[model samples]
Every structure is written in C-alpha cells, then in structure tokens.
Target: MDSLRHHPIRFHVTHWSDDPFSRGAYSSLLPGGTPEHRRSLGEVLDGKLVLAGEACNPVAPAMTHGAWNDGLRAARIAIEAGARRVLVIGAGFAGLAAARHLREAGIECVVLEARDRLGGRVHSIALGPVWVDEGAAWLQQFNDNPLAIHARQLGLPLRETDFGQPLAAAADGTLPDIDAAWEALRAGIDRSLPLADGVARYLESRDEAVRRATRFALDANLILEACLPLESLSVDALDEEGVGAGDRFLPQGYSQLVAHLAEGLDIRLNRPATAIDWSGDQVRVADESADFCICTVPIGVLRDIHFNPPLPPAQQNALDHLGMGQLEKVVLQFDERWWPVSPSGYLRWYDTPASFGEWLDLTDAVGTPTVAGLIAADALERVFAGRSDEEIALVACEALQAWADALRRL
Candidate 1:
C-alpha cells in the first residue's frame, strides 16, 4: 500500500431500517418461501381494499418503476371495481402513480403520506449543484421500465451505468477474475437449504482465497441485491427476473421522475393513516371514507396500520412469509475524485477483508466526484452496530483510503 490517502469533503449515510415509514430497503425472499407470496400480497381484499407496492409485485419487486406499475395496476383494478372515490395510503411510486391514474380516469383519489415529502424510498438530496439519490438511485432495466418510459417522455437525461464492467482490488492490489466464477455459479438446492448452505458446499473444493473471493462476489452482487443475510436468502431467489438488463443513472435525480408521476394529484403529506376500517362496504382510513382503498404502504411497516376485522389469513400469511431486507447506503462526495478513473462503473475492495462490499462510482457515472457504498445483510448490522455517524464515517473513509493506497501501488 502507498501513502496516497483521500477523504470526502462531504458525505451522507442512510439508515432506511431506522426510518419509521420504511422499515427496510425492500421485501426479500427467505428459505422455503415462494414468489407467489408477493402475488398474494398484491391481491385485493374483499373488493374494497388493495395492497400495492414493490413488495406486492411478483415480477419486479424491488424496482421503483415496478412500484409505479403496481400503483397504476391498483388504480385500474379499483376503477374496474366501480370505485368513484379512492383513498391511497403512502405517496411513494405506487401510491402516487395510482392516484394519478385514478384522477385521469375522472375518479376522486386522495393520497395520504406519512412523510412530508413525496417518493417514499426514492429519496434524493442536493449535493452542491448535483442532485444525488439517497435511496433508490438507479433506474434498473431502463429499456423496459415504465419509469424510464416516463423519464424519456419528460426529457430527463439518463446516463447508462456499465454494471457489466467493474474494478476490483485486494490488499496486495491483486484481483482475481471472480466475475467468471459468479456467472458460472451453480448451487445444489433443496427447499430446506438456504443460499449460504449451497455457497458453502460449492466453495468446499476451492482454495481459501478463492472461497473468500467468491463470498465477496456473492455479497457484492446477490446478497447486496437481495438485502438478506446468506442463511435467510431463499434458494428460489434465482427464479426472480428483473425488468431488463439496462441500468441507468439519473443526473437530475430519481425524484424528478417521482415528481413527473405525481403531477396534479391530491397528495396529503404528513398525514399518516393509522387505521383502515374495511369491515363495512366502504373503507374508512384516518376518518375519511372512500369507495376503494389502495394501500401502497411498504410491507416492512404494513402492520403499523391497524386494520379493522384484521386482514384475511392469506394476506396476513403473505406478509408473514415475505422477508423485509435491510440495506443502507453511505454516499461520499469529494472536492475532486480520489479514486481511479476507469470505464468500470463499480468498484470493490476486498483488501479490508470486508467492510464495504460494493461501491458505485458516481464520478464515472455522472461526473459527481462521488461514490456510494452499499452495506447489506450481516455487514449492515455489524458495521452500524455501536457506531455513531462520525465513527461510521471514520471507518468507512479508512476503508476507502486503504483501497486507494492499494490501487496507487498498482
């Protein structure tokens, strides 16, 4: 390692799990769980209520545009049910999209959000002149994404992220071609077995370094993407499909798309709907009665709202079975780029053995002079546990500095 070290001029760390409205980043699949659970969660209850969100969607569960699609789907379903007035809970992509769709259909729809802002998990903040996303950053699978379609319609510029290419470094500045191994990964599966078990079994024949590297690859890709601990990650997770292969970066920020979808909607911010009484013909949420209710509340905190007569056993079971995974971002913006400039949009340093598994080079993506590291599953809890923001930043910077030093030597 060399003497070259750098620290960011400014940074923003997110703790989405700590947020009351969004208990976790996204809904995950656990061992012995089926994707049908999501379909069940998306199902309308008693023809009077609908649960719509990314979690509820089986096709594209964690995507922002998926939430938007679900919202639109919910609105259509409600309209089909002859609903004149609808009350939408949560002003995220799903809720806002549903409200907009309903309004366009000449139906009265009011969106009630817990937070003062729009776009639930799609949060963004201004970093100088650049708008950086603190929550959902990438418009994953852009070509097929509905949100991407909207963004294009609105004339918002999007930069393509080359997720296929990535830079890697070890403590000795040696990086193995783990990408090949990852692509060739095959796990012997059974319903009782978790992803961890299969990975361990597969790595048993490899050397210690190879095993560690594979684990790192899994963490940086699969585990981080799922936001679930290895032991809990479902073996059936491989069955899930994304919108497409296009990964896009929004320079104007993810919120711009959210804003576009939210135009001309009855959105009431900071009005947390505590209860939804759907026992009668019409549903009454927070004292306002509506002919139909579309609850796009994140599945992580779905139980926070009191449902009168209780949700159906199938819906409750789906909520229970579906795992809510937590993944947080630590975004650092520097005065100048300290990291190496390369075509690779992602950077991963295993030199620290393991701290931050994956880093997105915003500098490369949109000339932000910034990088975002994702910490998920076990690492997320361990790193943040008993650590203040200052402490976390110190350690995080130390990891980056180590990586920089190693890369400098190379």
Candidate 2:
C-alpha cells in the first residue's frame, strides 16, 4: 500500500443500458422464460425477413462467434430465397458478417448501422499506447471456437487464458462451498422461480460467514456470468450442454477481427432503421427497399423499431419474456504497473454483490499497466447510478488499493 503511488492516468466505462442501438450487453434468460424464446427470435419471417445476432443463435447466444455464425446462416437463407439485393441493419458482428458474405455471393447489400463505428459489443478502444477491448474481448472455448481460427490465421498476437490456474481466494485462503448451491440447481428445482430463489433453497441454512462466501461465489460466477439480477434470472440460466475447451484473449484488440470481416463493404454509419415493412414481396426499411432484409439488431432494440403488419404474436411474446442483461467494463490505466502480476489468472476482490466482479491483469496481456474490471448484474447500475465515469474510476482505484493493502498485510 505504501509503495502504491500515482492515480490512474485515465479510465473508460461502457454504458450498454444508455446505448439506443444495443439496450444491453446480451440476452438474459429470465424466470418463466424458456430457451425456445431465444430460438423463436432466430426464426425467419416468411423467408423475406430473417434475424441474426448472438440473441438469435440458440447454440451460443451470448458469444461473438455465435453472432458471426448466425449472421452467415441468415445470409445464406436470404441468398437461397433468390434475393438480388439485401439490406442488413446494424453493424455488429452479425450484420457485418451477413453483409460481407451477401456481397461476395453476387448479391447487392447495403449495411445500415446506428453507431458511428463498427463492432457493436465487440468494441475496442485505445488506452494510451495499448488497445483495450471494452466488450467480448476473449475467444473463449478456443478448441472449437471459430474466432480463434481467424485470430491464428491473421497472425494476431494471442494469449491463452490458463483456466486451470487456481484463483486467489480470500486473504485467509478460505473459500465457500458454492458446489452445494450448484448441486441443488442440478437436482431439478422449480423453473418458474427466480435464480436467487432457487439458490436460496440450499444456502439459506448455512451460517453468515459461509453464506457470505457462498454469496460471493454466486455473484462472481452465476450472477456476473449471466449478467443479470439474481432475482430475475431463471434457475436454468447457467445450464449448459457441453463444457467449452481452452479460452484465448487477443492482445491486438478484437477490433482487428471486426475490421478484417468488414473490409470492402458498403457500410452506412449513423443510420437506424425506423421501420421494416416486410409485407410486400420486396422488404423495405423506411423508403429504402431491398429484395430481402436481415435485421441483426439486438432483441431490446427490436422493441424500439416499428414493424409493418407487426411481428408474429408468438415471437413477440417470447421476446417480451426474455431480458437484456447489463455487463459494463472500466479500464483503469496507470502510469506504471503496481498490482501483482500473475502468469495467467483473474485477480478477484471479494465484496457483497461484487460490483467490480473480477479483473484481468492487462500488464501481461497488453504490455500496459492497466487492469480491466467488469461491473455487471443488478449491482452494475447501483455502482454507477449517479457517478460520472471519473468518479467511478476513482472508486475503483480505491478498491484495487484496498486489495493490495490486504495482500501486503498477509
């Protein structure tokens, strides 16, 4: 603590909730909502209008690769429909991917993006000399991940996350039994109840200290993982089919991949599709009409844009049931590295609800003295409710120094 000097040089925080383009980071399966709702969003509407994004992908709904793959899937469907011209809304990975492939397949395509730049949730910003990814930084599940292949082929500098590395537990080295809560989850609980309610069934009987540790585990693992308020998440929110293999991080920022996918494409920036009229043979977005249109906007943004003849009642109901989650990040850039550097692992600081969930030791990842902290779940907004970005960053510096001081005492 005594050795720690100089405040952070600068900081950058994400405002997913404030962005009109993307209402939230990703989709969160709320209580009483089934996975079918996610599938329903991906369904094609009369073969003229198809949706593409991570939200539309049932396999890996929140993954960047999922959006990329689904965009290609949607584009192929549009191409098969004998469409000569296509309109792709939103410039995210899905929309860009769809537009690029459609153009290459002898189809005229124009991309409309609400944002000023490319890469929706896969945003990367320069922090001093190093570039830091604000969202979707990692190519997790590297063994089977398509993005990993792209990174390797491009010769982009990559860092494999050592998932096997043991996390630094509490200062006392005591950890809670989070397995029991997970066991209860696997034992088949009521799906109608919220995730917090389901987890309470088992942890409610434990002591305060144990319960605190267990709560930390839930906040860090499940709540933050789902990026939703525990009270709103479904019991099966974390349910998975197969375990993803190794995870990888891009040292050159994810924007390079976005740029590569977006090369030589006719992309119109700062354009938001006000309405989609798919009623006629030729689909239309306002006055601009195309043979087919692929709407890759986020589910929340879907509620904002008007659709002529309206969407299917079933799809509307399903989308209404699903929730958009908040996952924000702040990159604290310092003059020099003061935090402990590890070979490869997350530096976790335990707290109630875990406002700053976990941090990536960017010293090794980006060759800069920076640590990116993820603020997510219900506590996401609470921490940044009325504070400016600088205020929030200052608070984070305190949190980091506290953790450092704690370690020094040990």
Candidate 3:
C-alpha cells in the first residue's frame, strides 16, 4: 500500500465471487469433456423451452460473444418454431441478444434480469473521466468475432491489444530462455500428453534454470488466461482450440455492446425468476407465462433455480459435469502513468505466479493512468477469500510495485 502512496487518484475492486447474481466468473469444461456437452445442454426442452447462454455455446464457451451467438441461435430456433412471444431469463449478453434478435424477427420478447444492471458479466464502470470494464473487456478473434463486427457497425473505436507478446519479467532481472521451454511443452502436447503431468515430466528432464522458467510461464499463462488450474485444464481441448491470433479492446468499455443489443428490447431489471415451469403447453417463468421461454442464465445460476417437474436427465447431467472458473480483477487508477509506455499490454510476474501473476496496462487501451491486476482459480480463492477492499488494494499495489521495481533493475 505504501508503494501506491506516491501516485493515487481513485481505486475500486470488483469481486465477482461475492456477486449473488453471477456466483462465479464464467464456465470451463472439466477434464474428459467435449464441446458436444455444451451443444447437448443447449438442446430445446419440451419444444417450448430453450437454453441460450455461454454454457450452451459449443464453439466458444465462457466468452461474451459465445453467449451472444447462443442467444441468436436460440432466437432463430424460436422463430422457426412459429413462436410469437418468448420470455428470456437473465439480462446478460445472451438474454439481451436473444431478445434483440427476436424483436428483429418481429417476435415479441421480454427479458428478466436478477440484478438492476443490464450487463451480466460484462460490467463497465467509470473511474473519474475514463470508463474501465470490470468484467468481460476484450474481444478475442476480432477479425471473425461477430461482436467485433457489431462494434464496427456501431462505430465503436477498437484498439488492437498486445496479447501475443506479454512481457515475461523476473523479480531478480535474470529471465530464462522461456521460448525453448515452450517449444518442448508444445512438442509434448502434440504427442497427446496430459497437460499438468506431461508438463511436469518435461520440466524434470530439462536443466534446473530452464525448468523453473518453463514451469512459471506455463502455469502463469494457464492461470492468467484460462482462469483455471493447470491440472483442471484439458490438454486436448487446449491444443484443439489454439489461442486466437490477436485480441482487440473497446477504449470506452464493453458495456457499449450490451447497450447496443438492449436497444428496443423489453428488459425488466430486478426481476429474478426463482422458478421456471415448462412442463405444460405454456412456459412460465415465475408468475409470468409466455408461449416460449429462453433461459440464458449462467450454469452457476442454473443449478439454484427450481425447475418444475425437473429438467431432463441429460440437461441435469450436463450441469453436473461443467464447472465455473473463478477470476478476480483489481483496478487501480493513478494520477499519472508510471509504467512502460510501450505497445505491450500485459506484464507477467515470474515470481508471484500465485498472487497477482498478470497486470494489464490500461493506459493505452482506455487512455487512463490505470492498471488492472488479475488472479484466477485457486490462487484467487486463497488471496481474496473474505478479504476487504482495503486488503485487496494493498496486495494489488504491492504486486504492481514488485513489477515496477523489476523493470527499474533491468
């Protein structure tokens, strides 16, 4: 905390774990699971009820665009089925997209959101003059992503982010040859080896210095990007779905995309649906009844909702198999930018892989003197469990200071 005393403006930390509406950050496929599980989960129930969310999207689960695409898919299905009106639960990207597409198709729809806000996991708040995204911020695969296309159509300014070349800095300023280690890891992955086990075995065969750097890079990347522990991630899935070429960010914030989709849609905030009944001819969400119902709630939230007559055995099984990944971010605004002014976006700490392993430079992205520290999975749980805002801010500032000190030594 003393490190940040020199330059301070206003700081805020948003912990999604404490959010009752979300319960967790996003979805992640457990080991021995395929994208087919998500596809099966998206299957329509009773011909009048449908599931539409990131969890249902097989192509890109756990992404805002995935939720948006799934909503569009469900909306198309409802339209083809001759449904006049549809009830959408949750006002996140999925729910908003479904309602917007349905409205465009001339079908009436209503969206019920548990929280007062419109964006579910895509929250953007103003820190003084600049807007910073507290949730889903980046638009991965900008060239092909529909969300990116929509952003362009809406004339939203998108700046290319340096996700490919993240600064790998060590505390003592003596970094190892991580490139060679990464190559060896990739070779092992190509041979169809298990992620955690294979990486561990591969590191043991290498020199001590090389092994340490390799292990740090792999673990840091996995935790920082995947938001899951190395053991929990699937090697096959990772290899199959290779990292996107690049990523783009909205300078203003990602909330613009949600706001754009919400235009002309009937979205009711603070209307949480505790019960859903789709057994009969008409589908009912709580007290309100509609011809068709599209549930876009997250998997974490779905487990809690009471479904009358119970959901199909397959759907229930899918819920049991999939897991939610925990990720936390602490954003601190400074009076002036003290970090490097390079185009690079990320600073990965090799030493503090368990605490704040990664720091994102928002100066170029949002033009604000702000940096966001990211922690994921078990590390996030350990560090942020029941911690107050002051405690979190102190830890975040100290992590930033460590990186700053490392840069100075270099």
Candidate 4:
C-alpha cells in the first residue's frame, strides 16, 4: 500500500534481544529444571528488588502478553507496599506496560531502554516495496489475548490467516505425499476425540479412553514438526477448548502497538543498565545517572551481567544453568514466482537439513508477495551468522527449488 507516501510517516523497528541490555527476545527454557530455575531467578532478594519478565510467568511464559501481565503484577506489588517513586527498566512491551499500569495507579515512574527504539524483538522491516515483520509477528491465541482489545481501542484492523492449500517438501529431494499424509494425520487426530469421550458415552466399564487419547494427541512426530517437543507443549495447550487460537496481526506493525503504548510516558532511550545495587530501601541502577532502579531487563541479560553482593548462590546457579538458544529469521525476495504448483501461503519442506526450516510466504501476511522467511532456531546459527545477504538468498532459492521438485513427485 505504501502508506508512507500518503501519510508522510513510516514505522521503524529494531530487535531488543540483540541489544546489550536485552540478550534475547522471548524466554525459552530447556527440558528439565525449568520450574525450579524460574522460581530461583525471579525470587525477590527483598520486597524492594522485584523482577518481571515473560520467563517469570509460569502459565504464559516467553510470550509478549505474558511479560506485560508480569510487569503489571510486579508494579501492583510495589505500589501496594507504599513505594512513592517507581522506575521500570527496558522500554519494550513489558516496561511500557508496567509504566502504563503504574501511571494509571497514580505512581511516579520512568522507563529505561537500552536501544534507541521500543518494541524489543518486534522488529518490522521493509522488503522491496512492502513491509514485513522480522520478529514476534504473531499475536497467537487472540481470544484470551488482551492485546486485541487494545488494538481495537486504537482502531487497528485485525484479520485471520487463510489456509489456502499448504505445500510440503522433503530434505532428501523427495516430497512426502502431503495431502494424503495430512488427511491420515488429521483423521488420526480427529478419531482420538471419540476415544477421549468413550468413558462418558459408553460407561460400561472403567474406560482408559481418555488416557489412550491423550497419548495419541501428544504424538512425538507431531510435536517435533511443530518445533517444540511433545512434553514442553501440552495437548491441552493446543485444544485450548473454547479459547480460539484466532491469531491476528496489525497491518502497520507489531512495533506500532509498542510505540502506541509508549506514548504519553517518560521513556529514556539508549540507556543500558550495567548493574543493580539494591543496598537501601530504594534500589540503585548503574547508568550515566546513579538514580532509583527498577531492574526489568530480560533474564538472559540478568544472567550474564554482574551484580554486587552477588545473587543468592542458588539463584546464581540457576542463572548459570539457564541457557538461551539462538532463534533467527532469514528473509528473501524472489525475482520471480517460482512456486507455481501450490498457491498456499505456508510451505513445509522436510527434506532440508535441520538447520533449514519450513518456508513461509510473507506476501499474504504482510502484503509483500515476493518476500518470505525461514524460521530456524539454534540449528541454523552456524549457517546464518557469517553469511552475506546474497549468499543467504541463494541458499534460500536453492532450498525452494529443491522443495518444489519434491512437491512435483507428490
């Protein structure tokens, strides 16, 4: 649409995870000790020192909405204690949200950000003639997501993603029979429901139907394909009965929401907190100014940075043990529409190495027909880190070609 031409203003975004203050965007935990590590890392040294991040949230950890909720909770706790002046660190959604909540409660507050911009990891980039989301693009599970309410209030239009005919490819230069496989898989997934309700429908004997259905629902291959392992993501999390995974997006930018939230607030940009010194009732932060501190930095930063008097030994251990994985978004623009056979926006190519992930068409999602992205985690770190954009584009193009060949077989 090129609104910048008409509106005379354009949306800009940058990543907070790469910033020194924010080691990474969202929090992701390894398999074991996640619960214990969460409790210890976020345990308040005292009522004066409070911690809030997406990681601190048990129910909805590693999500923007979760981080916002945690910030509000932390601020409320501080406010309840009769703290006159409060400071929120990091100008991302969490910090901005915390500040907004504090302001609503009539508490004096300020937000500190390491980067020059807000939005944290929600970076929106322009690809050729169109703008595309480079980070945290999806507002997943919109039913329970309060962000939608805020979006509506801001007059932001939301739309659902259309599943027009997804294509699949294999890494071995072969295309798995995607349609047939998906049909079988869907049927398998669907048939489990009756088995799930067998106890209620046919109560002839003690039925273990629920247990069997639960096992099938938590299939290993399904979880792997979804990126997370079976155990980390629950079947209940997927079903989310009644709660629609009605994912919605903002046309302007996800960062626009962050910018909108930051308006009418005191936010200091390019201020990275090095250390936290909470000796007295009031916490002190290390920056250009030795002023009141509210440490709202990401957990990854907290783990790496030094703190005076040292965190509790157990907390320190948790910080040391907690590891952050490298998640990357590689975008490419095609010279021509090579994907002729399938017209879907989503394409899953299983044939590529683990480092190479499924190909996604950002055209429908972001109004950019020529653009797409490869969503890979730590697996692609070695490949993506040192490569030039042109090289990356070539690799992506070749991957797509291989994927297309595989699809032809199917």
Mark the 10 consecutive residues where model 3 has the least summed lDDT: 236-245
lDDT of 4 by residue, 195-280 (tens): 22432332333245433333222221232222343333323323212111566666566877887888899888887777777766
- Per-candidate local distance difference test: 0.80, 0.78, 0.79, 0.57
RMSD of each: 2.4, 2.6, 2.4, 9.1
How do the candidates rank by lDDT, highest first? Answer: 1, 3, 2, 4
Models ranked on TM-score: 1, 2, 3, 4
Which regions in candidate 4 have their CA more than 4 angstroms from the true location? 1-19, 162-166, 173-244, 287-293, 340-344
TM-score against native, each model: 0.93, 0.92, 0.92, 0.74
Q: What are the runs in model 1 whose C-alpha is more than 4 Å off?
A: 1-4, 187-192, 207-210, 242-244, 351-353, 364-368
Residue-wise lDDT of candidate 3 within 1-410, one digit each (tens)?
A: 55554445677787786687887788776665567778889998877888889888877777788888999999988987789989999999889889988988889898999999899999889988888899887887666688888899999988776766777567755877665666667765533555677677776667877777776667565555667787786664454342344677788989988888788889999999889988788888877888899998888788888998798988877776577778888888887887665467777777644678777788867767888887888887677878888688777887777777777788
Best by TM-score: 1
Clashing pairs in model 1, backbone N/Cα/C closer than 3 A: none
lDDT value, candidate 4, whole model: 0.57
Q: Write down the worst ten-residue block by lDDT for model 2.
A: 164-173
lDDT of 1 at 211: 73
- The digit string of per-residue lDDT tens for model 2 on 1-410 reads 23435588878888887888888888878776767887888788888998778877767778888888889999999988988999999888899879988988989999988889999888888888999998888886777678788788999998776644524444344555555645544564545556667667756676786667667667766777778877887766767322135777887799999999898999999888989998888998866899889999988788888898799987787787677888888889887888666567467766654667577877877777888887787776678889988888877777677666555666
